[model samples]
Target: MTRRICISGASSGIGARIAVDLAREGHHLTLLARRQNLLDEVAEQARAAGATSVTPLAVDLTVPEQVRPVLEQAGRFDVVVAAAGANAALAADAQTHLKGMAWAAWHWEANFRANVLSAVTLLEGLRELDALAEGASIVLLSSIAAYRGSGSGSYGGSKAALHPYAYDLAAALGPQGIRVNVVAPGYIAETNFFQGQMSEQRHETLVGQTLIGRAGMPDDVSETVRWLTSAGARHVTGQIIQVNGGASLGH
Candidate 1:
């Protein structure tokens, strides 16, 4: 059966790859992102990849006011992948930035809005719009940094909040037949996560930390998400699947 999937951050990286993968499987895709040009590019590619239908929605997730209107317009969907905030992971010198309480507060708010509230706003809008189709599945993007205290304190803290939120949401939406899950990825190269922001030394450290001896790709996370939304994962919900290649073990 064809699926209607709505994905945020669909302009690039993991989000774009996820949209394309599902589209290639003949799913209808509604792609949302901050950049209109990027979204259009992804949407066109999705159609070329065999998506039954493709709709591009350009909106920034940071501004709470912009979320609902776009999601409302996407209409109903069988799956929602809240994959926003790939680029807002952390600063090169996050430890220094975290020295002051004001900076700490700002970092916390920034990460929270980007990583948590963005998904929440979309969920709330879907609820209000009655847009989540029956047996709908929701996937929220998280990170291995959020699991172990090895990266930006603010970024991890913001992502940590998502675990409890997902658990509660799974229970809250269960009676309504909706399932919520979280995915925490390790060092992913396809998203250009380490470019310019992380030093080469730090990059080597992260790579060595991964048992797989390499960084993950956008497709790594996308495949995990695809499974969660598939019929095979119907029994799976409120779980966190780490795509870190065993990096968490070292952490």
Candidate 2:
């Protein structure tokens, strides 16, 4: 059956792939992203992939003012995917290795705004808008870095914060037939996460840690999200499903 889905970070990487995959299943999609051009591109791809309808909303998830009003009018959603996130330390360049409390504090705040509060704002908007359908599933995209130290500053810390939040959200929404869960992926390739700074040695080191002897791809994570959002996973909620090819094995 087709469902109405809302996805953040739907312009690229795993989020984009999930949108297309779900679109192919003939679902209606409302994509949220910061870049209108990119979001439009993904929307076209989703349309070509057989979506019943696709709406692209360009707004930064970190800005509640922008997110709330837009979501309030997009109609109710049967599924919500909170996939917008970034490593502030990496984005700021070389800040991850710096050794200063002040630097760490700034990095933590930036990462929190991007990773933690972005999702928070999205969910808050949905709640206030009454945009979540009964029996809806909410999936938050996370990283194995939350479980195993990435040494990339507070990226891991921010993602770790989502776990407890999902647990509480699940309990609160369970009676309403809504489910909340997180999908934590590891070493995914073809993503903008590395900011084009990944070295060959770093690639090998990451793959070596995985028992599967291969790094993950966007679909690896996206497919897990697809399943979790389906009726087949109705019994699952408030859990962090790791798609890391055994890397860190949830530590």
Candidate 3:
């Protein structure tokens, strides 16, 4: 059934693809991002794809005050996808390991704020709608890196924390008819996520690790997200569904 959905990071990448896909399926949407121009462009694409109604709210989710008013105005939604994220590369040219510690710390702190705090804040806001709606589903965008701590340090740790949060949320809200789950994705192409820092060799290594033998697309991740929020996945909750093309299988 068509329902109202709110998606953060909807201006691009997997989130944008999800918005367009769901709109084609006739869902009304609220697309949130920090870039107004980009959000408007995405909304237009969703409209062209047959969205029932597409609203764009551009706000920096890192700031609570900015996030509050936009969420309050958006009102109730059947599904909420928290997908906003940022990435910082650890300086690999350090003369000594200790020299890079400060840089890593800064990057880790920023990643935690963006990935963990943002999702938690949004979940808190959704509590306001709990009494008004029969139920709601939340899909948190995590990373395959969450399964095991990686070189990204804080970025991986932030995502790892989301697993427990999702599990606890599902258990706590199950009686209230709410479901929470996580989508841990592997390598998705055509996003500004890596900022083109990945080398051709690095890309090949990532693809080689995946059983699919190639990098994934935005649609690959979005399709799983769409299904997870649907009644078809009603029985599934508190699980971390990996969309990693068979990479990092054991974890």
Candidate 4:
């Protein structure tokens, strides 16, 4: 069944991979990101991969006015993947720690704005679309950090907040013939997520915890997201599908 889908963060990483994979599955796509060039490139790739319709939208999602219009223009999709995100690690030293208070605050607010609030806003926009079909699905891109409070302060907290929000969204929309779920991924490679801050030792330690003996790939998360949006998962709303290669012992 071919369906129209809208994806955020489609310029790179897991979102980009998902866009391509969905296109290959015969889905139509509306790709949104901050970079016009990158979004266009990804849309081109999606078209080549078999997307029935490919539209690239460039906007800074953190800005409400910018995001709102683009999302409204995107119309309705059978599935919406909210995958845009940003992260930063607060320095551990004392001076840096004090300085990081302000930094963390800004980052925390931004994370909530980008990772959590943006999804909610987009969902609102979707609801306004008369073109939305019944039984539509929404997949929120959360993180395994959402399970605990140990990682970067703001990042972990913002992600953890998403779990409850996703559940609430699912419960609210399920009765309306809409399904909402969260895909929590851990340590995916090839993403600017870490911003080159993770050390080799830290990377190895993360991989060692995974049952698969390697860090997850963008495709790993993307595939699970695809499944959750498919008809096979019609009965699977309000769930957090973790794709961490067994990291954090199923957290």
After superposing candidate 1 on the true structure, give the runs of residues whose Cα lies further than 4 Å from its correct spot: 86-99
Alpha carbon lDDT of each predicted model: 0.84, 0.90, 0.84, 0.81
Q: Give per-residue lDDT, candidate 3, residue 30.
A: 94
lDDT of candidate model 3 versus the reference = 0.84
**Per-prediction TM-score to the true structure, in the order listed:** 0.92, 0.96, 0.92, 0.91
Clashing pairs in 2: none
- For 1-251, candidate 3 gives per-residue lDDT tens digits of 77889999998898899899889988889999889999999999999999989999998887887777888888788899998875544323322333467767767777788789888777776675452245788899999888766676788888888889999988888887888999999989888787668789999999999997999899999999989988899888898898989987855
Could you tell me the TM-score of candidate 1?
Answer: 0.92
Candidate 4, superposed: residue stretches over 4 Å from native: 88-100
Pairs clashing within candidate 1: none
Candidate 2: where are CA atoms >4 Å away? 92-99
Clashes of each: 0, 0, 0, 0
Clashing pairs in 4: none
1-251: candidate 1 lDDT, tens digit per residue: 89889999899889999999999899889998888998999999999999999999888877768987887678898999998874343545344444567666766777788778877888788888889888999999988878775355777877878889999989988987889999999888757444467677877888999887997889999999999999899989999988988888632
Highest TM-score model number: 2
lDDT of 4 by residue, 97-167 (tens): 43556866766776677677767666766676554567889898888787765455677788778788888
Which one wins on lDDT? Answer: 2
Task: Report the error of model 1 at residue 188, Å.
Answer: 0.5
What is the lDDT, from 0 to 100, of the residue 173 in candidate 3? 84
